[model samples]
Target: MSTPPPALATPLSGPRFQQTSADLYAQMRRTHGPVAPVLLDADVPAWLVLGYREVQYVVSNPEIFGRDSRRWNAWDRVPPDWPLLPLLAYQPTMMFAEGAEHRRRAAALDEALGAVDQFELGARAQQVADRLVDAFAGRGEADLITEYADGIPLPVVARMIGVPDAETADLVSDVYRTHAAGEGANEAYARVRDKVRRMVESKRRAPGPDVTSRLLAHPAALADEEITEDLLHLMNAGQLPTAYWIGNTLRLMLTDDRFAMTLAGGRRSVGQALNEVLWEDTPTQNFPGRFAVHDLRLGGRQIRQGDLLILGLAAANQDPLVRPVPQASTGNQAYLSFSHGEHRCPYAAQEIAKVIAEAAIEVLLDRLPDVGLAVPAGTLAWRPSPLFRGLAALPVRFTPAW
Candidate 1:
């Protein structure tokens, strides 16, 4: 009585996510209207929800459009070397779990993250940003992605996780493979997980004032594996997107004369600039997928059970239904940059990422007022992947302050 799963057409994610530009998103919305059929991988079909209302609906009704991918029919047919397995594979953490398990796991994260002092967290961000700028302050040219943006999150997150700075620095190489989709990805994935395992073991042996220690002490009393998975979720969830978000904002601040003038003239705050960037070019363009639970009609499309549904947040943010906001940090949290619904990112309220980004850019520009792109804007190369939207490098030249 039910319709069979849809056949593959073209990948909805993958290289197209690299097309996070406003024009591309507009095209998707215009062509697909709200819901459009696109393959998740080459042969993996899924519906991409581009409407703001539709994304909210799908994410809010997790009971119907669930988080568990193991329930997906395609999971059984896929081979072990599935290139996208690292992303789509089921994990026991809140990221992929359903019902009561999601609550317990999410609680551990919420509590630990809630305990962080915003002032201190912002200070730590400033310190890290300053140090990174110092490394290249003497040179007139620096690749902001490698020297600044790409360098920010891991060490700060490592400290928050109780991972030593040295180890965090070493992870610079491995994190690349973990975020990318291709060869050596599995190996890079192993190294990062093993490192997290070591961190979990270290935290268990000697409790520290970090997220790991806090999770261990929480009422949930997560096991080592659960703690590791949750941390991995945080790493996968936060690391690259946050890094790229910072980079993208900086690019806008440095390149767009109108935006540059406003922020420089004090007409707009750094937070405001960030908010505009979120609305215009959301850091995480797509929210990977939410699989359907049963045969359901949504946005005039027939989606069968276990079919993946990707929410085009970048496109959705600009959806005609979504109006512009007056302030960046105001009560209007409608933007999908932090995602929406019950599964919304806990850090949406933190403002820690904004501080890190603002501080990093301000420090670099303060020392070198003339900083700008080392190459033409069009020449900037981006890492093409469905999971993240980011520049491969942001090469900039500046007047050496030192």
Candidate 2:
């Protein structure tokens, strides 16, 4: 059996270890100087890669770095006899799977998502946004994050995945809160697992054209257990990160007048503006946790087998080595926020950008030209989770065009 690496000592007394998400990122860059290595959570035995190249190297090179969460101490922190462990058990989702398995899952999701019409999705997004805004527009003061940003993406995912409209809101809320706070993680997991199992069983009785049905039809040579795991993976894929990115993007646009104006023009500039927002405010600041499968050398550091590796996506995205070229025709390459490797967030960023951009054009900017934050910029409360950066609420008021 491979031995675990030494535990990380507690962080030094400095502003770097502060709880502020933005500050923690800044300190990582300053102290690590691009490729410098830091440890996370004193007891977690992980190395943080803060440079652009280093992060890319670690993430993309699956042979050296792996996403087998089973190797990490995360589960160990929980009790071995805990029922939650089984529910929280890491499944071989696209994000955790490597090689052929990952490719297969990606292809399935891509095919399903590809079937969606961009224009139609945009229209749907606008309708959702309009209804949300209409509910609160009359109130004058509204929390954009809770009322709009958090509410919009769930139905979009539900519609795509073929969940009934009536159940989408509750499921989405449960999954979002569970994933974000690690609160009710087990309960949320169990709830979704049971739901998917029933859905799959029902589909067996009578299947439809939904994404889940499509996956069930192929099964891709996977077992029933694997199918259940994949379904849970899909549930997570559609919830937490989308909530984070949408909320973060809206916050950015509200804070910067130029960005808001640019997006108001229409979908033509929406993509570029969204890219800027992602670069400026990464949704997932820390790298998705990975475990070293074998002895590996990365950025002049020797990583032995069993070492925990944390690729700092937010830090790498801002690395001066990969300078952001706003005019780059290729979109946002400098930003490693979604990662760039075997376990990268697989078109998630792109999808969210499209939704947010389309909504900004069709809803916010065009319909509420004078809409903006009622409070000053810095007063907005950001979510305090270490994994994702997002606003808790964005209280804003605007003049209705109607």
Candidate 3:
């Protein structure tokens, strides 16, 4: 006999996804096993893969669970302007591409990102950090999320991808809107898409040492639309998670006694804190993930063809079977913060993001050695986002240096 679905589905959004998700995931695991049923924004049903082994199996075995969003069985229930269409709607980009086509685009993206000089990128991040800190240093207090952590990645990424200086701010705004899934998300996605197309045209006219130029000139010989669409994927995917990574790390350093003791000049601990955040508080919590290729059993649940499986990255990291004790995990990079397998975030891109985040955190500490949370740490609010984990605001106080 076939296994039946759970009686009630957990909504992927709202307070359940907020501060208490660890508890929530625990409940789901107890009630529904490794693969728990879930409902997206508009009552669209899917499964949240919560076990470490189960998540790994799903992402690694793409032959069974594919990346093609077009194969989703719930599309008929989705509206054209559904807030999540920007994320779920199929695009020709490598994010939704599968098989040989995915390999083609992934190769170009990997090579292009790999070509970036890590040392130069680190130096560039420091420079960006210095300029940003300069703006808020004399104020004695600032919201680090808006003024610091949220500000670092986009400018560095824009320069990396050859987005013109003048256009970077607007691009940042649109990307934020689309990721936040606000009322204007659809329009924001359209604007960002058009902007990337124009950027590809500009790069073609005069190729530079940027990622876009490299993609255009790569041996893969990607077409304009391919490059343009992937660039949109590249920019949007790179910025938000990275920004949240930085924010979450800073929050850890400020709030936790383990890291707070290092606030003054514990430069070495910055890396430790960053690694811990990945394991405990990964930026991308639940990735809208692979669709089942055929009916099969996964983690004791009966999965159907075209069934969507959300890879629970955070929940998987917390799986008792894999995670080490808290003290032992500071140096452990075994976490699945970056999804695993063929379609995982490229190794090259992960290194670049680390350089950017580490530099942002280190530079802030170097400049404002006494920086501490301006509000009671307990009062800080997390952004009301289901897909990403980040603080809505990170206010801090420091001695004025001017």
Per-model TM-score on C-alpha atoms: 0.91, 0.84, 0.97
Best by lDDT: 3
lDDT of 3 at 31: 86
- Runs off by more than 4 Å, candidate 2: 1-20, 33-42, 73-89, 219-224, 260-269, 324-331, 400-402
Task: State the lDDT of candidate 1 residue by residue for 202-279, as single tens digits.
Answer: 899999988889989998879999999888877766567778888888787777775667543432456666677787
How does model 3 score by TM-score? 0.97
Residue-level lDDT tens digits of model 2 in 263-364: 445445555556765676767677556777878676666677766667777766766566654334226455776678656665743675467445734576
Query: Between the candidate structures 2 and 3, which one is better when assessed by TM-score?
Result: 3
Query: Candidate 2: deviation at residue 52, Å?
Result: 0.9
lDDT of 2 at 56: 74
| lDDT, model 2 | 0.64
Better of 1 and 3 by TM-score: 3
Estimate candidate 1's alpha-carbon lDDT, on a 0 to 1 scale: 0.75
- In TM-score terms, which candidate is top? 3
RMSD of 1: 3.0
lDDT string for model 3 (1-402, tens) is: 222335788987786577678789889988888889988777778899999999999988989999999888888777777888899899899999988999999999999999999999999899989999999999999999988888888889989999987888898889989988768899999999998899999999999999999999999999999999998988887889999999999999999998888789969799989999998889999998899899999988888888889999998988877764654664768788899998899999999999999999999999999999989987877887668999999999999988
For model 1, the superposed segments whose C-alpha errors exceed 4 Å read 1-8, 13-21, 76-79, 262-268, 323-332, 348-350
